[model samples]
Target chain A: MPKIVNHEERKRKVAEACWRVIQKKGIEQATVREIAKEAKMSVGSMRHYFSSQKDLFIFSMQLVMDHVHERIKKLPLSGPPIKDAMQVLSQVLPIDAERRLEMEVWFLFTSKALNDPDLKKKSDEMDDELYQACRLIIEHLTVAADWKQETERLYALVDGLAVHAIMRPGRLHPDLLLSVLENHLKVIGQNV
Target chain B: MPKIVNHEERKRKVAEACWRVIQKKGIEQATVREIAKEAKMSVGSMRHYFSSQKDLFIFSMQLVMDHVHERIKKLPLSGPPIKDAMQVLSQVLPIDAERRLEMEVWFLFTSKALNDPDLKKKSDEMDDELYQACRLIIEHLTVAADWKQETERLYALVDGLAVHAIMRPGRLHPDLLLSVLENHLKVIGQNV
Candidate 1:
C-alpha cells in the first residue's frame, strides 16, 4: 500500500517554501514551479495543492498571518502578569531567526497588500487583531495607561521594533527591545 | 535674460520631481522620462542634472533626508520643553500634507533600498541620523527613563506612528497619535 500524504500538511509545506522564495528572491520570483522545486515536490504535485500561482501567493500570504496568530495563541503565559505579558508580546518582534523570517514575509505581504484588494482586506483584519491584543494587555496590567493612547502607542511600538529589526538588526537587540517595553510598562504602574 | 538654472538647484528640482512620481505611482513606475515630464523639463536636461535613473533615485532619497533635517532644525524649541519636543517629533510623521508626502516617499524608497545599493547607503545614513536624534531627545529630557531603553522605544514609537499614519491614514489620526506620544512621555517624566 502506498503511503498517504496529508493534503493540508503538504499545502502548508509548499506555502512555507513560497515564503522562503519570497525572502531570498523577490515576491515575483515565487512562481509555482520555483515553489514546487523549493518544497522538493513536482510542479504537478504542487498544483494539486494550489490551482495557480495566484492561489499559491494568496496561500503563502495567509500562511504568514496564520503563523503569527499561531505563535501568539500558543505563547506560554503564566506567572506574574507583567512578566508573562512581556514574554508573550515579545514573540511578536523579530528577536530571533524565526520571527525575523515572519517579519520579512509580513513586510513583503504588506507592500503587496497596497495593490491586492484581497490581501488588503486580510491585512486590515490582522491590524485589528493586533490593536485588540494591545488593548487587552494594557487593560489587564496594573498600569492605568489611557486606553486609547496606550493602544495606539503599543501598536506603533510593535511595528517600529519590527522595522528596525529588519533594517538594523545589529543595533536593536532583543534584550534592549525588551528593556524598553519593561520600563514603559513599569512607569505606567505595571512591573515587568 | 533666459533663466539660467544653477546646476545644484536643477538637480534638487529633478530629484524632487522623482519623489512626486514615486508618490503618484509605485517605485517601479518612476521612470526617468516620467520624472522628467513631472519636472517639466526635457529628458536630456534632466540627465544633465542626474546622470541616470539610479543617480536620480539616489539623489531623491537624499533629498528627503535633507528635508527632514531642515524641518527638525526649523522646529521652534523656545516654548515648554515637552510641548516643543512633541512638536519637533511630529514633523517626522504624516501629521500634515507636507509630512505625509515625505512619509509616503520615504516608505517607497525604503522598499527599494533593500535591492538598490545606492539607495541602501543613504537609507542607512538616514537611519543613523534618526537614532542620533532620538538619543539627543532622550538625553535632553532629563527624565527618569533608562536612557538606552527609552531612546530605543521612543524611536520605535515614532517610526511605528509614521508607518501607521501612512498605511492607515483614516484610522490613526494625527491628533490621537500626538496624544499617545504625549501621554507616554508624561508617564516617563514630561509634564504640563
Candidate 2:
C-alpha cells in the first residue's frame, strides 16, 4: 500500500529552509527565490505549499513558536515544580546550536513582526504564551509574593539571557545562564 | 542676518524622520523615499546629508544611542550609589513615549544591523557600552561580590525589562519595573 505524503511535514521542511535563509541573509532577503533555493525546491514546488512569500513567512514564524511549545510539552515532568519549570523555560535561551538558531530567528522575525499586523498578532500570541509560562512557574513555587511582579522579573531575565546569549555569547554562556536562573528561583523559594 | 544652515541640526532632522519611519513602517521599509517623505524633505535634500540609505541607518542608530547616553548622563549624580545606578539604568527601559519609540526603533534597527558589517560594528560598540555601564553599576555597590556574575544578572534584568515593556506593555509597566529594579539592587547590597 502506498502512503500519502505528510503535508505538514513537507511544509516544515520548507520552513526550516526559511530559517536558514533568514539566518544566512537576514529576514529582508528571505524572499521566495532565496527560500526556495535554500529548500532545494523549484519555486513551482514551493508554490504548491506556500502561494506567496508572506504565506511562507507566516508559516515559518508559527513553526518557530510551535517548536518551542512542542519541546516544552515533551520535557520530562519530574523534580520540584520549580526545577521542572526552569528546564522548560531554558528552552527559550540559546543554550545550544539548535536553540541558538531558534533564538536568532525569533529576534529577526519579531523585529519584522513589529510593524506587520498579521505577524504582530502571531508574535503577540507567542508573548502571551511566554508570559503565562512565567506565571505558571511562580505559582508552582508556593510563594506568597505577588505573581505578577515575579513573573515580569523572571520573564525579563529569561528574555535578557536569550538576547545576551546571542549578542554577547562569550559572556552569557549556558553555565552562567543556569546559575543566574537557579539563584533567581531559589530566592523565590526553591530549596536548592 | 543670513544664518548658514547648521549641517548637524539638519542631519538630526533627517534622522528623526528615520525614527518615525522605523517606528511607523518598520525598519525594512525605511528606504530613502520613505524617509524623505517622512522628513518632508526633497529626496535631493535627504541625499545631501546621507548619500546612501546605509549611511542614514547607521547615523540614525547612532543617534538613538547618543540620545540614551545623553539622558543618562544628565541624570542627577548625588545619591546613594544603588539608587543613582537604578536611575541611570532605568533610562534604557521604556518608561515614557520618547523612550518607548527609542526602544522600538533600537530593536528594529539592531535587527537590521545583525547582518550588516558597518552597522554590526557600531552595534557591537553599543553593546559594549551597555555591558560596561552594567559593570559600572556593580562596581558602585557597597559590598563586594563576584562583579562579573552580578553584572551579567543585573544587565540581563535591565535588558529584560526594556524588551518586555515593548513586547508586553500591558504587563511590565514602568512602576513595576522600577520596583523590581529597586528590589534587585537591594539584594545586591542596597542599604536603603
Against the true structure, whose DockQ is highest?
2
Tell me the lDDT of model 1 at B27. Answer: 71
Residue B83 displacement (Å), model 2: 2.1
Per-residue C-alpha lDDT of model 1 across residues B60-145, encoded as one tens digit per residue:
88888889888878877877657777877877888998888888888877766765567878899988888887787777775544
Worst 10 residues of 1 chain A by lDDT: A183-192
TM-score of 2: 0.94
TM-score for chain B of each model, two decimals: 0.90, 0.93
lDDT of 2 by residue, B1-192 (tens): 646899999999999999998889988888899999999988998898888988888888899899988998899887997778888887777899999998888887778777888888888888899999988888878455667777788889998898888877777788898888887787677421
Say which candidate scores most in TM-score: 2
Cα lDDT tens digits for candidate 2, A10-40? 9999999999988888999888899889989
Off-target runs (Cα >4 Å) in candidate 2 are A1-4, A190-192, B1-3, B142-144, B190-192
DockQ for all candidate structures vs. native: 0.49, 0.62
DockQ of 2: 0.62
